[model samples]
Target: MQFFASLVRSVYAATILATTGYAPSFSGDTKHNAVGAAKAIESFHPESSFETFDVNGIDHPLSDRPEFSLEDAAVSFVQSRLNITSDAVAFRTGYANDVIQHAYIHQQINGITVANAVANVAFNKKNRVVSFGSSFVQPSSVPSNTPSISVTDAIAKAESQLAGEYNGHPTTLEFVAKEDGSVALAHVVQIQDDDQDMWVEAFVDAHTGDIVHLTDFGAHASASPVYRALPLREQNVTQGFRTIKNPQNKAASPIGWHNNGVTKTNNTSGNNVITYVRGKGGARYTTPQSSAPLIFNYMQDPTKNPNATRANVHAARVNAFYVVNTMHDIFYLYGFTERASNFQNTNFGKGGWGNDRVEVSVQDTRGKNNAFFYTPPDGQHGYMKVYLFNRSVPMRDGALENDLVVHETTHGITNRMTGGGTARCLQTLESKGLGEGWSDAVAEWTEWTNATITDWVFCPYLKRGGFRIYPYSTNSTTDPLKYSSLKTLTEEHRIGAVWGNILHNVYAALVSKHGFSATAKTDPKTKGGNTVFLHLLIDALALQPCNPTFPQARAAWIQADANRYGGANKCTLWKAFASRGLGIGAANRVDSKKVPAGC
Candidate 1:
């Protein structure tokens, strides 16, 4: 529950003009419509929350910077439209420092800024307004010579071109409708190489209505070709050991929780990077490929061979493989089942239980941010390191360790997909709880598919685990806040267990009709297509900038969901769940207030 609180608080924003119950005072000569729009936003506070969507199991955070104001948008739109000089009326919002942020767009003639612009000028409550802050550029070009083209039509063309190149690269674009009912292209950005790249920045030629000088940047280099064949050392298993112990157990548990072996460096065509060597005994050690000869398990003992058939060893390899293959670009995994400090202290810095996965940094072997930990042992986050603990061995007649592997791997996949960020906040309580609930759902689904549990549902691992996140029963549907009081729970472990059960129910219902292979069309006209629901959840969580409450979380989810699945998507899931037994009302508990009126 405390963990849930951390998740919400860190992932999860005000108003004014309407406070007097009067329209904002403005110079009679200025455009009042823009002012009205800004006041409406200020009154409702549009940039308060965020959400996300997913593709498959990938995450994509939708950030809503509360700093945006109607004044900002107006100033920007005006600056670009009027081709105003560097110094204008000092268009700044009064509350710029409090809740508003200054947005700017620079006019680049070649590569440098020829002129900078400010946007969203409005008096704050104090009337001082943004006297000083970050500067934003307004469009300064008056494109009267260029032939006018509809922004919507241009965007459609761009989108069609981009479809062939997305290749898992996340992207974004800003579109505004023109007076002629055509779309105007503002800016296009794409997330590439773990950074944001601007593809285009322009203003519609006011006179000609044609696109002026649109630029594209930050396209990703094609992914390096994957070498599907095993490395040269696979056949050699001489580095086997009878039993292993952590020699550094009395000391720090070797950097990352997932660090399994020494850091190995290699170079083929002048390109080189450090790689991990997972040892047979589980104890981690450091080594460099350029300096030391590569050590294989078979090198240690000719008689003893590392057995991939063994559940523990197989699970370790699978985990290792996932780290190298899937998330290799992001992190350097060390031990499969690494441990840090025993408890939550400065020395340990909130490390998870011994069985959790540990992602360490290759650059700093002993730095604070070096190792990122994940726990829960059952959901998408839990699967991050489950293979290290269970080792995929069969304890019963019909048991397989792949369940745990898939479960933990799901977490890794989710984090990588979403870039592991947080979501926005909300006024409602249900959103925060659902955030946890979604993760639990991942765990429950993974477990059911990977492990051969009799019931194949959540909370089956505990005694009296009859579908309660604690004493609260989410199954009852009467209380959507079932897991909200996890902080006050007498016993917290049951919180995750219970939530997992509820999520399991959701998954079962979804799969029963859609089939496990069902895909989300992503086109609004289609039904039951959002194949990326799991990815959407993770992406939403990753985008959360601060801790999130259930209500806030619901808002973020709605935003992300609609952004990814469109407006009517809420019903797609609701109807599916109702048919599965969860009922439509409970399934549709997500918050819709934070989103715009229609979308």
Candidate 2:
């Protein structure tokens, strides 16, 4: 069977690559030696070697001189002083106030860029280099450029190794450098595995017909049977049986339900998500399945029946699955491709690479009323745990709260998209705060799009008066928090509140100018100010640098708008940012609590 499969793949690859002229290189595994790179930088500047520096695993400090030119001097130092032979090409460079100038440089060998190898350098205002780092592949010896096997044969080998269905063709051909500095001429193929819900990049050795590297871009993930339920927001006064859309159904007419799945053990039929009920002891156990789809009946009165409480919990789980899947589809319409980090088990191979799924755990703790999202590194799946209602506190089940779920899920999205889909990149104090702000902003947008809530309040049940420090509104006076507020705030969530306020203002301004469209809510293709906001936000994530600060993030957003709309929304965006103290002149260091003053 294996031999037959290999033969079939070879035939298919041959047929596909016959018409293509040349293939571009794809990213492969590259081991970054930060310590070694730091040592190299230290060797050049012995005076600064003895001074202790705070290096973020990825960067090493050099000196604190304020007059250094990052573009000219730093690049020159890396090429002249370092042992790397590849030509360094500057791709990104920026400065923050009088603090530091940072640059990102890519290495190229034989006219082909080395995948995942980069040199990052930062210079202080005193003209001295303060930080330097590299994830560069310094090969000991150059290999023959000519390949022994054809590109088609390499693709065939890669196809034969795939465990699931995939689509798309080879995107590039280049020499891939391994962790040990060994290089090989390889065909880089882009594929989507729908069965596992992943976008994949497979690098096949052209000479050996072996898949030298496989990058799972990440598979980017539900339920029902009868269970009681509440309104999307548990605190809503309106109550009774309500029909909710079932996201799992592929057909035009999806399942409409009132109760959560009762008979489904794993909710496997939905295929988008798998919900597990781990009761008080954190042990997986079975819950009663209902035959009727009337799960909302359980939420009418919480004290009615023990079974009713279970049914209510189940209903929330079902709703969470639906909301998250809907969020996935909505973002997909706006360009969150399988390669961009979505939640699904299968794309079959049309979109990007899979295996990045969102795992939801309902009733996580015995009586803890809280919810959180955990994003693992790229290629790894993320899990969200929505704890049960606190028995002693005024809080209700977090799973029942759509806003909370959306907020947490947004965390996963931001973490995955920022810093090129790596969790290790967004670690600075400002970045952490930005992550929280993004979650809040996205959650608010989701609510507005659905027309489920008029005002943005994180959790109403948790705080009867509303949970957020300030409700998201069009009125600036309602939430006076601004970028300058970061100067006094140290906590991430608090700092995030300021950011959320700014976004809310932007959302309001756009709505006022473009007019909120109901059509956009249901149609992903429809363009509205709301859609524009989301598009720019997501695009900015791709453009943002690692460990970005407020100014850097603002620049990314502006760049995203330029890339997408040709700077159509520049005035409005600038005004919105300026209102929040993150205007053109806003500049602050990554570690500083002081906020940048707007122009």
Candidate 3:
């Protein structure tokens, strides 16, 4: 979700497809009505900005707090903001400390759920609306429920768009809302062509039998061992093998890594992930490792011939298993939990869905120079393929590079969290670029051994420089990616470098003030700039709007800080972002190198 490649290249594709094919970002007649909240909001905080897409609350209590509950307030706010009058309802509530922190609502008209019409409202400890994102398109009118075409015809209409047969799945009737303010009653048909590795949701027009819209949900990793999984310092900066047993984090993998509770699995298969290898021979289900650990320490004297290490095939799988499971554990501690729709086969009866553990293919012979991750919705399996590179031994296995693993794995995180677990956001060119950037930033965030954060390139061992066009650095010359660079760069990863580098500076800015936390992973409350940045980063993913532009993302980070730390880091964040041209005035993918006064 690698050849379809960039989880997008299969992060930017070689041929950047026009993401305009997806539904346009939502806007409605309610834009004028939302300004009332803005005026109230500005009374408390002077710098707040409101749009049809997202609203950030000021630092003070919301004036329109509902008498009943946060859900009631959410419904009311969404109704006022999005102009959705027909039975606005809160379907999900996100809890933090025995209190509702956020409410998720869907727009329903005439008893039918408006496709992709959703909004999220967040509350602080004081039950105040801190921020919210809306893609809810409240139409001027609703179409008839009756379908002019049969379901069979709708399916055929969907299938006719491509050459492959429809992957066997059920079709449902729903309304497909467009940006032009027209709503079409359609059959949402899901088609998966395994051969093409293509899976998409096709909105077949029920009235006209024409395809109204299509969303490719497959939006589209590791290890260590003294038996030797590598570190974030890259493959060459090997920390060597360190023996570890039961490495799975207790809270993240409560049921252990190997067993899914329903069936006994001794192999690398587990509740969070399942690792396997596919040979070039095209054999099906040909390789899944056994539980028995092996000494994959064979380097085959890489100086002599790196490809000779191919004798130890299982070593890559072992490293991959370690890294994948470790990332699952580390990020879970940050915020990606079972309730947040994280990848896990079992949720221990917790919130969110299950049976969606990551499906990882190590050293997959599919492509070179890249690894990819394709994330479906919360309940479906995520697919990751790490291919082999030809340069530098350059017949290098991508699984050995921890950077690649982390980068690919994070695609799942950004995808699920961005659009409230829909995995349908981040499909636009800029959003997809953000997706690539977030993945790279997360990789850079985790792989640190000291407080002195260094400027580093990605997968330098495989590629001469890095998989990206530039090293994520604070140096303007080496990584001189400003917000303005985004306008010139159309490819996702290149565009990602700009965003990622900006975050790189942001991380540096935060770390300089609060210092670094060595125990970041083990301690949730580790109060350091690096740790704080991670909180802001992940939280911002949920805070941002669907198909977010650079400015929207920057605002989300500020709002996330407001919700998390009561705006303590607002000045620090503004300064960091401003230094990189994502200051108070950045918008529409333009670079603005200016911060607010007093920052």
> Best-fitting candidate, measured by lDDT?
3
| Decoy 3 TM-score against native | 0.59
Candidate 1, residue 585: Cα displacement in angstroms equals 12
Worst 10 residues of 2 by lDDT: 40-49
lDDT of 2: 0.58
- Model 1 misses residue 430 by how many Å? 11
Model 2 sits at a Cα RMSD from the real structure of 24.9
lDDT, residue 97, model 1: 56
Cα lDDT, model 3, residue 289: 37
Ranking by TM-score: 3, 2, 1
Better of 1 and 3 by lDDT: 3
Show where candidate 2 strays beyond 4 Å: 1-241, 246-270, 279-300, 304-308, 351-353, 391-395, 449-455, 589-599
Best by TM-score: 3
lDDT scores in order: 0.29, 0.58, 0.69
Q: Model 1 over residues 1-599: C-alpha lDDT tens digits?
A: 01001122221100111221112221111111111011100111011111111222211111133343544454444333333332332343333457433434332222222222222333333332332222222222322222244545444443343321222333223332222212233333221121122233333233343332233343533212221112211211211222211111212332222222222122111011112223456433222222212211211211222232333233233223322222221111211211211111112333333322233212122321112225323111222222111112321100012222233333443333232211123212333334334544554433232112234333222212323434322244533333334445434234444344444543444344444432121121223322334534544554543445433443444466576657445554444333323332332333221223332
> Candidate 3 on 109-184: residue-level lDDT in tens?
6667666666677766666666766555435456788888998887786666644466678778877666565677
TM-score of 1: 0.31
- Cα RMSD of all models vs. native, in order, equals 25.3, 24.9, 23.3
Which regions of candidate 1 fall more than 4 Å away from where they truly are? Answer: 1-315, 319-400, 403-439, 446-455, 458-493, 508-515, 518-532, 542-545, 572-599
Worst 10-residue stretch by lDDT in candidate 1?
34-43
